[model samples]
Target: MSYSSHADEDDDVEIEEEYLGDYASVRSIVKEALPFQILATIGGAVAGFIFAGMTNELEMIPGLIVIAPAVLGMRGNISCTLGSRLGSAIHMGLITKIENNPELTNNIYGSLLLGLIMSIALGIIGHTMTVLLGFESAGILALTSIAVLAGVSSGIILSVIAVLLALGMFRFGFDPDNVVTPSIATIGDIVSMLMLFLSAKVVLML
Candidate 1:
């Protein structure tokens, strides 16, 4: 009876330690997150540059501006979620190495498909809003086509990059969660914006 009571007490103490971490644990967490924060800042700057660079494309494509923010935000949101899932998979040891992995492929495919569908929907919504707001906008067909093309191309490229980054971090014996945020924000933003404008250029041919 006394032994069982001591075991229970020990379990309670461990739970407390887990929740109320000591100073070293807190310091370690901050140290780990600091680098990611810096990288995220750099990503924000790059995203800003992309935003500025798209001014001409936006002007050239009548309805491009309407869907621009949605496209940019959608990429980050989806890719970030994908990266987080991958990070969890890595921690769970469900994924080993970066190649010849069926699990990785499925996750990538799902994220891509989701992004593609959202892109088409966003294009339609943007086109509708633009027309209703009394703004001169491109035809629905043109806008929707641009969104589908851009979203697919960017999704494929970013999925590859995301998997590589997630696996790379784990292979190097580091936590992917530590930096996936910045990776998704930075690289995803750049690629998505570039594809958006490039698709617009092709569709508008202006």
Candidate 2:
């Protein structure tokens, strides 16, 4: 009986080792994907079109008007990029979350905190630059506040979606390299534009 038990333990160890080896192979496969990088470029072009249309419709001063769309686009792009990176990292066991792994959780929190700070700074700079350039349609403080809020919210939301989608793909044995980045970026752009438009409309009403 003891001999049989020992054999069972050995089998379990071998199985675990095989699983680990397979995981490494999967990670390497994902890393080799270069074509996936084009998603960022594609996402950017799409964002440009959306922003142009939204801003043009507003009829605000071109200089002041451009700030909202430009910053929103940039924020959305950065958020999507971060989401892709983090999603990949999380899947490869490079990071873990509190609910999943304590270290990963801390890293996610830190990323979000930084996102908030960056959003505020970017918004303020965009509004200030326009104002300094003598474009007054987008009231500096109000527009800045809106930009900051939108950036932070968009960043956090996209990150969460990316992580969830990546995990789901992994569970289903799907290739995240082919699935995640563009989808998250495209979705993020849509949401970012909507947020910017809503905020601008609200500010104008105030």
Candidate 3:
């Protein structure tokens, strides 16, 4: 009985050590990721402020307010997905270095194509909703043009940023999964808002 008890005690100690080691590893990753997360969150807030400042312009178009959030949210969603996929590829050793590769090219094209299709759909939906709610709205063609142009412009920029950030974090020995999505989301918000505002201005002018 005494010998059995001693062996059980040794096993418990080993298990405890293993648990502690795993905890420490997770803590280290969180520590490494926290700063980048904080910065990205701050960037997101700034983007919100910019969006708020565009209220007057949005009011002029009546239904544009409906379109704005969809555009911004879509950009963030697409970019976030892109970041996650690239991070996974990095972890899997599929992206050994940051250069032109089939995986990267496919992801870029796919994301951009999706963005283009969704932008047109969102524009139509936004315009329909505005009319149904008895609000004046720009023509569907104009709205669709605005959404597609802004979306494509922002999408292109965000794709590059996501790829670079993921690769850069991996190169620095940090986990790309921990940093890429949040960072791209923040950047996506800012760029999408800016591009939307500019696109609206340009489209309305024409």
Candidate 4:
């Protein structure tokens, strides 16, 4: 009814509007980020398929069918998991060097160590499976074991790389969400396959 009262009401409304605007922006960011992450994951899987064709000529059918999936899955899974975990840590404002967060550093190290153990185990399993199937590959078991171990080691290395990249990107004013997951997953796929080959070579030489 009075001019001052009307002015006061207008000021209150503007404050509410600003708050709502901030809330909406936050929600939009969440909505956009989640879908982007999902889409990136699917795209990474597709890329793996396309790259498998390049290696298909190497071992032919069985190589593409068995070896490709094993290497690809192991790398992708490990890298993606580690990347996601690191990203979450950054999001929670818990990112510090080992000197700062020894627990975090040790946890990541332990995970990588476990990966190595799994790699050895998987190698044994791969070799045993091949033998059980009556495949005439004498030193295949040893080769398989080494290959998996090598892959695990490679995965561990890549996990470290991913963490470094994510931290650096965050420090350089980039979103870890956009920087870490996709890049790491793609790199992991390629590196895992490469390590698989290297492991096979090492075992063959032994």
The positional error of residue 136 in candidate 2, measured at the CA in angstroms, is 2.4
After superposition, candidate 3 runs with Cα above 4 Å error: 1-24
lDDT per residue for candidate 3 within 89-201, as digits (tens), equals 98888887656688888988999999999999998998899899998988688788889999999999999999899999889877788889888888888999999999989
lDDT of 4 by residue, 1-206 (tens): 99999999999999898866653467745653566567657766765665555553344323223444666676677777778778778878887554567546855776577677666656656556666776633444554565566567677778678878778877876567766877776667656766665565565566
lDDT by residue for model 1 (6-100), tens: 99999999988875563237665676668877877787777778778877777767888888878888888999889998999888988887678
Candidate achieving the largest TM-score: 3
What TM-score goes with each of the models?
0.85, 0.64, 0.86, 0.65
- The deviation in Å at residue 23 for candidate 3 is 9.4
Tell me the TM-score of model 4.
0.65
- Model 2 scores a C-alpha lDDT of 0.65
Best by lDDT: 3
Ranking by TM-score: 3, 1, 4, 2
Looking at candidate 2, the ten consecutive residues that score lowest on lDDT are: 55-64
- Which TM-score value belongs to model 3? 0.86
RMSD of 1: 3.0
Write the residue-wise lDDT of candidate 2 on 1-206 in tens digits: 69999999999999998876665466755653444556656766776676676654367533436565565557655766666666677568775442566555654576577767776676677767776877664555776666766666776677677777766765677556556766676678766776676666666666
Residue pairs clashing in model 4 are none
- How far residue 136's Cα lies from its native spot in candidate 4, in Å, is 3.2
